[model samples]
Target: MRISVIGTGYLGTTHAACMAELGFEVVGLDSDPKKIEQLASGVLPFHEPGLPELLRKHTASGRLRFTTSYAEVGAWADVHFIAVGTPQKAGDHAADMTYVDGATSALAGHITRDCLIVGKSTVPVGTARRLGNLVRESTSGDVKVDLLWNPEFLREGYAVEDTLRPDRLVAGGDSAAAIDLLKLVYAKALKSGTPFISTDLETAELVKAAANAFLATKISFINAFSEVTEHVGGDIRVLADAIGLDNRIGRRFLNAGVGFGGGCLPKDIRALQARVSELGLDRTMRFLSEVDEINLRRRDRVVHLATEILKDLQGRKIAVLGVAFKPHSDDVRDSPALDVAAQLFNAGADVSVFDPEAMENARKRFPRLNYTKSAAEALENSALTILLTEWDEFKELNPTEVGDIVESKAIIDGRNVLHVQDWLDAGWRFESLGRRSV
Candidate 1:
């Protein structure tokens, strides 16, 4: 099977490479010449664990290729995956469809025969039907394009694994041909017992947004508990473990700390809320708004804790550990750790920040903040330290050794990953969310 994946960003690039690895001839198209050039040279623009190796393997075998022209993509395949970004629009929470519209229109103009155009980007419900009309109109009735929604659910750090063996596959299109083609394309997973669900276009689009909304809600739900836990002097981690033991309540996304801050969760929730309101369901979006507020408040809580610890943040040397929204990924789109660091700096703290992989991206977002090469370097002579993201390096730090680097042995366990008793035993004053430690 020949497939063309448009827009070689994180989703597009990973999708293209994985499809090629699945024994399909894949062509990746991007408007950015630099991105295309880099991919052509077997270089990936972003950091995804095991992606470089996968891209290299497929590109070297000539099963995967990158191109700058949509004409090539249109002519090269019977199936074209529209994986362009639907970023949150400025001044509004709705997703911007400019990239999606442009990619679909361009693909429509170049195709002369029947083709299946699958949307892999997260979009507002009913976008697929609208785009189908636009494609038919642009093609001047010369080509038949079947629009399908196959929203991607791959997380940044686990993109390759998610693509190769997805939890489930949701496809939606009006035509049986389009649905069957997608089924065949993902037959390996279907054969391996991965649920292959087919529905209408609207349901398929809502499935992606709803899935993200649920994950965001789960994180916020725990963070909300963290708030009450702090007041009641309760250990949220232990509480979460106890509650998660229930068969109905799963353990995933229950970590209570700085909260979720990534490219997907933060934006998708707001976008989903905004979309719901636009559809005349304003009351239904209230819970989502609270979820977003809870997530944002966690950042403020971290900053407030730092201020309280130092008595006065003004002229206080504080170290912030971790900037990425999560570990093992360099993306810092809405990172909670970086958000707290920025708030602290604004509140007059002399903050030094460090992260294993997100420093470069964080630097771009917060150029005014001081960035250190190592966590210990960031903690050097610090009055207070905060572990914002639970990276393995941060988790495995020796309490005694870390205590020696700082002038004041005070630390905030933002993610609750640190051993509070161990730090306390090492003569360090440890403060953490959802727990009592003096």
Candidate 2:
């Protein structure tokens, strides 16, 4: 099948490459000329583990390509996947639908033949139905265009794997042909026993938001208890493990760290809240506000812990071990680690930040803080250190080796990936978010 994936951000780029890997001719489309140029040259504009090699290989093999022209994509492909971003609005909690809307309309106008236009973007419920109407209205009567909501459930670092071998597939539309086409598109995964959910457009739209909201709630629920353990002196990690032993509550997202952040959880929760409010069911999703508050407070707790450990922020040199929201990806959107680093820098501390893959993006987002090329450089002569993101390297740091380079012997395990006794035995004062300092 010939495929065109619009909006060559993380989701689109990964989808296009994976589709090409599936033996399909794929073209990734974007309005951004520079991004298109970069992708066409086999140079990904961002960091995603294992994606660069796939992109380079496919671009070299002539199976996958990129272009900024919707006309080129519309006239060329049998399926068009709308993978545009729906970021939270600047001043409000609602999602900004401008990109998705524009892309759909553009695709509608340029399509020369009947094709499936599937949405992979996370959007407010009712978006597909509305966009479907727009497509119907925009397209010529001679050409048939079916809109399907097939929201993507891709994790950042594992987007390629997630796309090729998804946990399940949720496709929403009334058209039998559209559903079959989608089934054909995902035949490889379907054959491997991956569950495929067929539902109405609204349900499919809500799937992404609901999933994100639940995950965010789970993280916040644990972190809220972390706040309690911080005062009453219990181990949050142990508590999480004990509770996680129950099959009902999974251990994932149970880590009580600087809370959930990235491109999805935070914004999706807020967007869900905003969407429900718009539907006049404002109080239904009200608990998400608490979830949001609890997540933000985790970041604050890290800052407070840092202040307590350092005694003062002024003139102190602090090293932030990771700035990406989580390890294995460089997306710093709503990142707790980066925010903590910036907060400390704002308070007159000399902060050095380092991430395995996010230093450049972190610098672009928060430039005032120092960016270091390596973890050792960031830790060099620092009064205190904070392991904010659970990068493998940061999590596996040798306590004695790290202690030797620091000016002081204090550390904050923001992600709780460190051994308290190990740091303490190395003559370092260690603290983590949910544990009492040792």
Candidate 3:
């Protein structure tokens, strides 16, 4: 089956490459010439753990290709996946639909035969119906374009694996042909017993937002508990483990630390809230707003904890361990680590930052702050250390070694990835969110 994926960003690039890896001919289209050039040369613009190898493999075998022309994308495939971004709009909580609109309109103008235009981007509910009408109106009846909603649920670090082996597949469309085509396209997963869910377009769109909102809520819920735990001298990590053992709550996003701040969770919840307001559902949006507020307050809480550790922040040498929203990825959009580091820098602290992969992106975002090559380098002679993001390399660092380098031997476990006893045993003062200080 010939498949064309529009937009070569994280979602599109991973989807296009993985589709080819599943033994299908795939063409990835992007308007950005530089991105196209990079993909054409087998160099990925962003960092995804296993994507580069997959891109190289598929491009070398000629099963996957990159192009800048929507005309080529329209003509080359029986199915086209609209995987462009729907970023949060400026000065508002709503998502900017320009990329999705542009990609859909471009595809509509070029398609001359019956094809399924599947949306893989997270969008407001009812977007599929609206885009369906747009496609029909643009195609002038020369071609029949069936709009389908198939929202992507791939996490950043585990994107490739999630795409290839999704826990479940949810597809929504009015047409039986659209359903059958999607089944054929995802035959590998279906055969592997991956549950396939068929729903209406609105439900499918809501699924993506709801999934993200729930994940965001889970993180915030724990962080909220972390707040109370802080006052009551309780350990949140142990509480989370006990609650998670029930198998109902399941400790996925229950880690109490710096709350979620990535490209998806923070913006997606706001977008979802804005969508609810657009639909005249203010109550639903209000609840999500609280979720957002809770998530954001965690950042402030981290900052407040840092201030409490040192009586005054002026002229303190602080080291931030990780800057990416999460580990194993270089995406720093709305990153909690960067937010904390920025707050520290603004408060007259001399902050040094390091990340295994996100240092370059962090440097680009906060050039005024110092960037170090390694974790130890960032901690060198620091008055306090902050573990902002829980990268493996940061988690594996010996508290004793870190204590030996820092002048104050004080550390804040922003992500709750450290052993408090180990730091205390090493003769260092350790502070963590929602946990007893040692």
Best-fitting candidate, measured by TM-score? 2
By summed lDDT, which 10 consecutive residues of candidate 1 come out lowest? 136-145
Q: Order of candidates by TM-score, top first?
A: 2, 3, 1
Tens-digit lDDT string for candidate 1 (1-438): 899999999999999999998999999999999999999889998889999999999999999999988777777798999999888899999989899999999889888767889999999887899998988888757667788999999989999999999999999889998899999899899899999899999999999999999998998999899899889888899989999888799888898988897878878888888888999999997899899999999888888888788889998999999999899898888889899999999989899999988889899989989999899899999999899888999999998998888999999989888877888899988888888767
Weakest ten-residue segment in model 2 by summed lDDT: 415-424
Q: Per-candidate RMSD vs. true structure?
A: 1.2, 0.7, 1.1
Better of 2 and 3 by TM-score: 2
How many backbone collisions does model 2 have?
A: 0
Clashes of 1: 0
The alpha-carbon lDDT assigned to residue 321 of candidate 3 equals: 90
TM of each candidate vs. truth = 0.98, 0.99, 0.98
The C-alpha local distance difference test score for the whole of candidate 1 amounts to 0.90
The alpha-carbon lDDT assigned to residue 146 of candidate 1 equals 88
